[model samples]
Target: MSFLFNTYALARPALFSLDAESAHELTLKSLQKAYDCSLTRGMMASRPELPASLMGLALRNPVGLAAGLDKNGAHIDALGNLGFGFVEVGTVTPLAQPGNPKPRMFRLPQKQALINRLGFNNLGLQAFIANVRKSQWRERGGILGLNIGKNAVTPIERAIDDYLLGLEGVYPHADYITVNISSPNTQNLRTLQGQDELTQLLQPLQEKRKALADRHGRHVPMAVKIAPDLSTGQVDIIADLLPRYGIDGVIATNTTLSRDAVKGLAHGEEAGGLSGPPVHELSLQVIARLREQLGASYPIIGVGGIVSGRQAKEKIDAGANAIQLYTGLIYRGPALIAECVQALKR
Candidate 1:
């Protein structure tokens, strides 16, 4: 653990100095190399027991590396060894995009948060599928979910088409599929959350899910990833709609737009969504509210502001079946995975 911290500390200054987007690319490249050499796998394998089950898939643990860290299906094998019970890849769209302009992602070290309007930049479906096909991780077998989304240019009314396109491309490979409708970066994307719009969008997708399950001879559960900024009314609406569509799970609280927790930080005013320590309370609130509305049996995957084992446990106690991390991993490093796994055991 000290070695991991020291190495990252030495490298972090150089990486942090680069533009955030470039730094992310470099990080992914480094992980890819570590994976090719089997270094990351060896490092992660020394961790304590990390096993759990949800949505009919057995996970090595409940602590998963969230999507957006691996926008495309690039580093699954490398990340898998980092002690994550699962790895969610892609907010892949039907069409590839460059996303928002540079200086789009910013780090607030003091606040232990990140603010980014990355806008789902990805290699399109074809490139994404090619990348997934090249991965050696898929054969290793564990819970791998693909988070799907519509293109930036696609209208909300026709959003289902793009989701369908993404589903078709990723369904065969993903253990489950996540329908992303909450990103604040994309224009009008959140409108799909409306009752009428949600039903229209999900009904067709649910039918498609059934067809895909029959065709593939596997039951691929579909989970919905929602934003953290929702009002109580909106949360109730989603809880009401999820079961009607046969949705398998919900990933509560994507990045938040609120700056209440990180009020005085240097990058606090950045326009993108805020994620990390500041988001913990609101995220937990959403989880608790959803649990009440959806009933205790509904599966929920908690995310946002989970920086420690106790925080992760709070989400679980609030009714999350599993939890994922992005900002926490950024601030805490790989050792956090083992720490959370061990802490959960106690």
Candidate 2:
């Protein structure tokens, strides 16, 4: 583990020199090559077996790789080797759409933050599913989640159609599915978080989930990913709606539109969601609010700005039953996973 950590430390300068998106691509490709050579097996073996339960699924640990990291499910086996109890992919849309324009992703190294308006830019559902099906991680008993969202061209009124299609397509393949209504990159997408709009969305989703469960003879849990910019009242409203609509879990935050924390830092004024350490407190607040409203037992997959094991433990103390990582992986590398697992274990 120390060697892996040292390796990433040595490579960090090169990864950082490139643009964020290009570096992202290079990292994924490198992980794929490592997996192909079976170099990842040792990393997997060194991971602790800290069994946990969340939304009725048994997890090898409570640490998970969050969505948006592998949006097309192309790198599940490679990422799973990094010691996540589960891996989630996609914010994939029903149809393939080129996301936001170039320079869509920016890094704020000063703050250990990133601002991306990638707009669910993915290879569409068909290709996403194909890649998912090609992965060996699921057969290895790792929990995999498929996150669903609407396309860029799809108007908000018709967004339900896209989510329905996503649920149906990813159902048989996923151990769980996440309904992503909270990405800041998509226009009007966060409006789905409102009470009336949320009601309209969740009702049909629960109905569809029931039908899918019956047909597949298995009940796959659905979690809603929410934004960190929400008010206490807004959080409470969502907390009330989730269980009423039979949603299984809540990923406490996506990212924050608020740049208050990153002010004066480079890329701090970018027009996209700000993630990493900047949003950690906001995520914690949302988690605390959700736990207060939803009660102690309701599962919350806490996310946003986790960059360390102490921060990971802070999330768990804040009301997260399980936690996921994204920016942290960028800043801390694979060692953060073991550090987090150890923290939670302690």
Instruction: Please provide, for model 1 over 19-107, each residue's C-alpha lDDT reduced to its tens digit, 9 standing for 90 to 100.
Output: 76788788778866776776554653534466788787888788887888998887877777777888899999989999998789999
Clash number for every model?
2, 0
Provide the overall lDDT of each model, using Cα atoms, as 2-decimal numbers: 0.85, 0.92
- In model 2, pairs of residues that clash are none
Give the TM-score of each candidate: 0.96, 0.98
Cα RMSD to the true fold for all candidates: 1.5, 1.0
TM-score of candidate 2 against the unseen true structure: 0.98
Worst 10 residues of 2 by lDDT: 38-47
Question: How many backbone clashes can be found in candidate 2?
Answer: 0
What does the lDDT come to for candidate 1? 0.85
